[model samples]
Target: MTKPIRKAILPVAGLGTRFLPATKAVPKEMLTIVDRPIIQYVVDEARAAGIEHIVFVTGRNKQVIEDHFDVAYELEDTLKARNKTAALDLLEKHRPIPGSTSFTRQQAPLGLGHAIWCARDIIGDEPFAILLPDVIIKSQVSCLKQMVDLYNGTGGNVLAVEEVPDDQTQNYGIVELAEKINENAAHISNMVEKPAPGTAPSNLMITGRYILQPQIFDLLSKQDTGAGGEIQLTDSMLKLMETQPFSSIKFEGRSFDCGSKAGFLSANIAFGLDDPKLASEILPFMREMLDQPEAAE
Candidate 1:
């Protein structure tokens, strides 16, 4: 029988050099999006997909992320004493169940492959999902939930993919699909990480959210660094595809790459526009910014 996917690995060890000063002491995953940290959105997606345990592959200065998932006794008590039921309830709603999360250190910035490998012990002998906290997928049905539904039926290896512009294809891992199962699904025969500009096989790119069989842990066990002197997950996946049934499910949503300055700003704006507390205040502020003569130039 195909083992059910119950655990998810979140790699949060990357040094956010792009956000430098802001991430100087804080882990990038703790950066807020409409008041909730980026990792919170990723965890919410995992929970929605019925994930029971979340394994975080962390590094230095990532203690805040662990604390974010833990209960704050004093804060909860203060909110309860002040009759802030709504605030207290909101906090409780997002908290992960006690002992539902496990943390392990990646030890080095080897690569995404190594980061995921760090969680190997926690994910022994079962299919697991890997989620990148930097990529926030906005959808009616959470992206991971959507992928989990596909994983149940297909079960070998599945990736969450989306269409990208031809020119933008060089920045992501591109795939060469064999056949189309449906509009949003395809059989991926092969994949290439960041192909040269204009040499991409298809516009589809593997963004984030992967459901991989446990055997992949073996492939990653001795993976050599590729593409950038770092062990890349795509390289390991390419080797796995030689034998496994690999497919990509295009997500029905927008993805915000919150790892860069521009993408981070865009996510803040996008989520800010969706939040009730910030909507009214930001709407006029945005309109005024757009109306400024400098914007037209």
Candidate 2:
């Protein structure tokens, strides 16, 4: 039987160079899509998927991320005293259980594999999920929840994949399918990180969601620097595939690559359109922008 996945690791150690000036002081994870920060959205998805423990692999200038999860006693008290019930309830919803969350410093920006390995002690011996905060997934069924459901049945590594154009496959970790396991899932024969265009094994590219086994820690421990002299997670995952069965679930969700400025802007617009209070105002503003002659020029 597949061991139930109870923990989730979030690697937020990267310097958001793409976001530039805005990320200079504030961690990119704190950047809000509409109202909530990016990391909060990821946490909410994890909670929806039944994740009981959250381990954040952090780096320098990342203390704000830790404090975001911590209780704000003075703020809560102020709300309570002012009789602001609704506002107080919203803040309390994001507070994590004391012992259920943990933070570990990654110290250096080695790579995704190293960041994930940093959580080894906390993860111990069970399967766990990894959700990249940069990839904000908007779905009816949360992306992590979809993977958790697949993990319950597959019992091995499960990665979230989406079909990308052939030419764009080179920009992502491409997965080769050995066989079709289901209508929307398949057995991943292998995965190659950022394969050269036209040389990609398949069009199914891995997104940021993953349900991984504990054995991956062993592989990552011995992993050498691969592409860009970084301990690439895809390299370790490829090694793990040799000894374990791996599967890929084609996630039925819209994923925004918030790591880039364009994607971030797009996410704000998409999320804004979904917000009931903002939609009516935002739509007309967007239409006005479209109708403006200067914007066209």
RMSD of each candidate relative to the true structure: 1.2, 1.2
C-alpha TM-score for every candidate: 0.97, 0.97
lDDT (C-alpha) at residue 269 in model 2: 95
For model 2, residues 1-297, the per-residue Cα lDDT tens digits are: 889989999999999988889999999999999999999999999999999999999999999999899988999899999999999989888999889999999988899999999999999999999999999888999888888887787789999999899989878988899888788888999888888878999898889999999999998999588888889898888888889999999988889999998889999999889988899988998999999999888
* Residue 209, model 2: Cα distance from true site in angstroms: 0.6
- Tens digits of per-residue lDDT for model 1, 225-297: 8877988888888888888999889988889999987888899898888878789898998899999999999
Q: How many clashes in each candidate?
A: 0, 0
Q: Candidate 2: lDDT over CA atoms?
A: 0.91
Q: What would the C-alpha RMSD of candidate 2 be, to one decimal place?
A: 1.2
Positional deviation of 16 in candidate 1, in angstroms? 0.5
Kindly report which residue stretches of model 2 are placed more than 4 angstroms away from their true locations once superposed: 294-297
